[model samples]
Target: MTGTGFGAFVRRAHDAGKLVVQPRMGMSEPDRMRAGLRATRDARATTVGTITLDSYTRVGDLESAELALLEGVSLNGYPIVSHDLATTAGVVEGLYGAGFPIQVRHGSATPEAIFRALMTAGLDASEGGPVSYCLPYGRIPLSESMANWSRSCELFVRSREAGMDPHLETFGGCMLGQLCPPSMLVAISALEALFFHRHGVRSISASYAQQTNADQDAEAVAALRRLCAELLPGADWHVVVYAYMGVYPVSPQGAYRLLGRAAELAAGSGSERLIVKTVAESVRIPTIEENVGALEYAAEAAARTPVEPADSDSQTYAEAAALVDAVLNMAPDLGTALLLAFRRGYLDIPYCLHPDNGGRSRSYIDSEGRLRWADIGKLPLGGLVDTLGAPAITSGELLESLSYIRRKFDCETTV
Candidate 1:
């Protein structure tokens, strides 16, 4: 059987009426990393493999990563550039292909080096974007990240040229993790996917992270799907939902309940893949067993829950389409259009601190816990921007909104 691309693999699962599960797992030791991959592969669920890079490598500090390796320092994630090609290849030997494709996840604004290293090590799938990887993670200048990602996207396409298809996932959807409105997330994800498609990638995935409200999240995913179908016509794409990337619940039961809801949301909203967060997420790095358990749990939740397709023609869709169109109409190309969009306030992420970001926008969770725009800057959303009604959210309310999901899930109904 000819194993199709990573995007195809997820699409096949979605077509087969299943959701593919993934974990945010990474380890510095090759043996541990290999073990994690093997465990994910053998888990009682449909899964994809991830090798998240350490902070040193993420910031383009290969020398620091190498020094930590030699000094036996415990790094947070696998240092892809620091490892030799043979070592990285051996870690995924016989593990990356067909049923399991490993995606190199690095939080790098400058991912050119990361892309080159992963491609050389025989992996072609990775995630990040010029805007998403830049604004939230570091202080890297936006233009530099844009230039780096343009080069990285071109680097990603080399896999297809080498007879191995490559996949690029956009981290745009999960920007700022929580409190950012669903419309902004959907729009950014679509824009980044367009950027990737323009850079010669044939397979891509647009990501959406679970937010405070289930109904709103479902609407956002549906909106994202519609926009992607309309904008990314020539590319193979899928929506991957990350389980609440914000403040996680401390209690195991709360964590499990939240994760189960995430799976249900993914299945109902027609997302092909769901990224799982372990019960230990609030405390520390999860073990392989914890990750495997989370995967299985998510899979089981997805199996029992019948899908309820969201309405694609909803207001969310209209708002997202407006945002996307406004940005695309700004300039001829997506890369430059994105930069100009931010500069002109046509695309503004709420609470984002980047100098490139307009910072005029703000979002707050309403009484129903649905994320609503407290201010829209100049997002070109027409009447939708008026949803930023009345008095602005106080700092205390902002704190409460940030902890909304965690507080709800962690409250005890049973002793």
Candidate 2:
């Protein structure tokens, strides 16, 4: 069978009642990269391939990447820009098709060159957003990142002229991976999806990372879906869930159990795709076999997990809708609205250290293991959420909250 574009491929899989699983594997060597993709395609699950970019390429340091390639030094990920088009294409020449669409997962705030290289290499899908890619990853001014992403989106959409439908996933929901409340995560994700849609991207995916509480995560994902349906009038969109993105459990059993919970979250919440994390996540980068094992395990877990009824009237949905509406009312254009929202502290992320961040917001893990807002900053959720008598989270409490999942899962495995 011939290959299909990334968005269409994923839509087909979800429509066929399969939850697509993907890995975050990348290599410096072309042959090894090709092998990784091959393994993913051959794995015993519905899967997609990822070519994560190296650090130098992610920061626009092509010179260092080229030097490392020449000196035979191993970089963490595939340097797509430093490597020639022929070399990059050869890595997925016969492997990338409808059955296995490959996406470039680079965490670059300024990704113009990265997008250009991926498009040249015939890659039709990538993930990252202006705000989501910027604040947590680097010190690049939000304005600059916004301008850069605007150009990148314009460049990515041009693939349509060549009969390829380009796909972009928002990393907004997974911002900082943990500690932030579900309401903010859901709101940012929906806003970023709206940003992509406004920038002419027709095929889009909104991402949400699994937080501490399963029920809360389910509520958040449901809220995100509802917001997208109401906001994105005529766009092809889906929800993608990433396994717990904070500190992972150290034990093998704990890791597997955590991954299983993530798969269950995706299935129960009706998310179309899941990004799997291996058992070696806490120690080091996982091997090809480990990634494959994680993929298969998640697939098995998803297969038997039944979908739960969505709660449309939950607190998550109410708060997220408020945040999105507040931001949209800030300005005429989505990008400008985002910039103005951050500048005015209308959307503050708890515990995020970037200078662009308001830093006034703070969150804590409640007694029931649910993430709750300790301080809401200038966010417009005052009416929906009451932080009136919430105790301020101390440094000691913050550290413990950061490792909440790791401790919970690891302790459970040992017991």
lDDT of 1 by residue, 1-415 (tens): 1233788788888899999999999999999999999999999999999999999999988889999999999899999899999999899988888789888899999888888888887776899999999999999788889999998888778777677788999999999999899988999999999999999987999999999889989999999999889988888899999999999999999999999999999988878999999999999999999999999999999999888878988777888889888888888988888889998998888878889999998888877878887777788876766763545878898788788888989984244
Clashing pairs for predicted structure model 2, backbone only: 3-98, 4-98
Each model's TM-score, in the order given?
Answer: 0.97, 0.99
**Overall lDDT per candidate, in order of appearance:** 0.89, 0.92
Candidate 2 per-residue lDDT over residues 1-415, each given as its tens digit:
2225788888898888899999999999999999999999999999999999999999999999999999999999999999999999899898988778999999999999999998888889999999999999999899999999999999989988877889999999999999989999999999999989999999999999999998899999999999999989899999999999999999999999999999999998889999999999998999999999999999999999998847978999999999999999999988899999999999999888888999999888888888988888899988888898887888998898889999999999878
Q: Give the residue spans of candidate 1 off by over 4 A.
A: 1-4, 412-415
Number of the top TM-score candidate = 2
State which candidate has the highest lDDT: 2
- Stretches off by above 4 angstroms in model 2 are 1-3
TM for candidate 1 is 0.97
Number of clashing pairs, model 1? Answer: 0
Worst 10-residue lDDT window for candidate 1 reads: 382-391
Report the Cα lDDT for residue 85, model 2: 91
How high is the lDDT of residue 106 in model 2? 95
Report RMSD (Å) for each prediction in the order shown.
1.6, 1.2
